[model samples]
Target chain A: MYQNPRAMPSAFQPVPALAIPQGDREGALLVAYANGDPEAAREIMAALAPRVLAQALRMLADRAEAEDVTQDAFLRLWRIAPEWRQGEAKVSTWLHRVTANLCTDRLRRRRRSVGLDEVAEPEDPAPSVAARMQGEARLRALSDALAQLPERQAQAVSLRHLEGLSNPEIAAVMEIGVEAVESLTARGKRALAALLRGRKAELGYDED
Target chain B: MTRIETGADGGRELDDLLAEARALEVVPSAALWARLAADAERERPRPRTVVPAVPPAPGGWRGWLRLLGGWPAVGGFVAATLAGIWIGAAPPTGVSSVLPSLWGEDVSVALGVDEDPLSLLEG
Candidate 1:
């Protein structure tokens, strides 16, 4: 069920769908959690928290705020577990959407009080200091560029390119139609490209 | 160095940046994981259908017997039931004599049932 990335019509192809088969497992674990199976709590965290945290971090570019969003998203999931209609929506997809929305809200609030320059670089604990600095710079540049796009566009693009979700999965996360997702991602990529055009060389991308 | 002048060039650069961003791993801290697990536990629904670790109370006669306060109560009930059945099956001499006294003559004769107009309607 994996579509070749190159064949995708969008300029920025989504990462392959190789790890997309966990939806069923996630749903089952959620049901188990709702049924009061204690171990399922840890299983749910293991299965989802990292990806959710990563998405939030990418969106907010602030570790602490991203953690808060991840926490809030999980709390919402926990509250909705008993009522969650299985097979209707994937748990991870729902979580991604919640996480994205939470990040968007925080972003809006942050925009009012703080400039994009104040958005700190997401911390990464790489072993090499130089490499870590370089990585942080690139990440910060990408995050700032993403911050410039509209919330939905940034979310769609991030889910498509950075998070590696398929177009349908992105649609599910965004609660929109597949065509809308495609359009958002296409337009998002164009906008992102334009935003990052001047910073390419500084970020180490040059004519090859 | 050629600058990104066309959409294709920018797209290529954007792809590289996205790839790098994707490669930048974002593992959750142990504290965050623990916090989420706590949230899960806090919000998890209590089991709706709890099967008793001990077997369920017996139904039917056993339940009825329990409700009646054990074998002693049941013994008294059984005794009373048998006594009533025996009395119905075979009346005592006193009971039989009393029944003739009450039924052989019209009780209206003693109680003046015939005097009452309502008694005529009843008859």
Candidate 2:
């Protein structure tokens, strides 16, 4: 199904919700992988790699680095399968945490390489062609705004909203209290709204 | 002021952004899963017994034997061998009595005893 931009703002276009799979099935698959089932490993990879890649892409804004993050995420996953505890934490939560840490470490390295004392979004960062398509401008703006948020808040918002994880799941992933998760997301959303307020027309909202 | 309504609209706009984010789908390359499978193949050698839940076919030649009549055939062969050995060593009570020549000698001759033990032997 295609959307005519004239018919409705892409923002208002109804979107089918992301299926947040039960962490238990994922947990069971991990157990299967731990027990050396290659099929199970394949299943886990298929199920999780896209989400890992998505989170990485949003965080790093570099395809090569995001791919690397995804690969590393899975490599670590392969190594940890044997020691994985099934019910203690959701598999997706653990994966998001792993990918986030990887992204943060890479970002830190980039900051150090640039000799900047503070980690900052690179100035005039060029979005890839695929990132700049018509409907995706909003995503790019949101991503840019996300990049500007304090790193923790950015990550919190990314996990909570972009990654479709619930507050409790994010709390488990971020290793923070649910109330803290609530605070971070609230602050992050408010900051995002303020940042993008001026660009509404350019970003193609308010046509209605 | 219109600012309050703007803020409310902005929040709705933010909600819309989140929905769009959810709509953003990224699929990993097929090669990624292949690489993981290769790694899993390599690293799967944990010391735990990996027996399938369905219980894999018994493994080597034992599996073959299982496929072909398992213990019953082997047990029958063993029983037959034991019976043959017992017969060669010492047959059952009636087994030898019917044919004394089968032993190749008169066992009574060894003791110099007549067929009727009640008769006194002539010197």
Best by lDDT: 1
lDDT of 1 by residue, A1-208 (tens): 2222234353221222233256477777677677776655565677788888888887666789889998999999888888877788888779888887887777667657766456344355555875666666777777777777799998888888778888877888888899999789888889878876676556656755
Best by DockQ: 1
State candidate 2's DockQ. Answer: 0.21
DockQ of each: 0.30, 0.21
In angstroms, how far off is A3's CA in candidate 2? Answer: 31
Quote each prediction's TM-score: 0.64, 0.56
Per-candidate Cα RMSD to the true structure, in Å, reads: 12.8, 13.1
Please tell me what DockQ candidate 1 reaches.
0.30
Residue-pair clashes, model 1: 0
Number of clashing pairs per prediction, in order: 0, 0
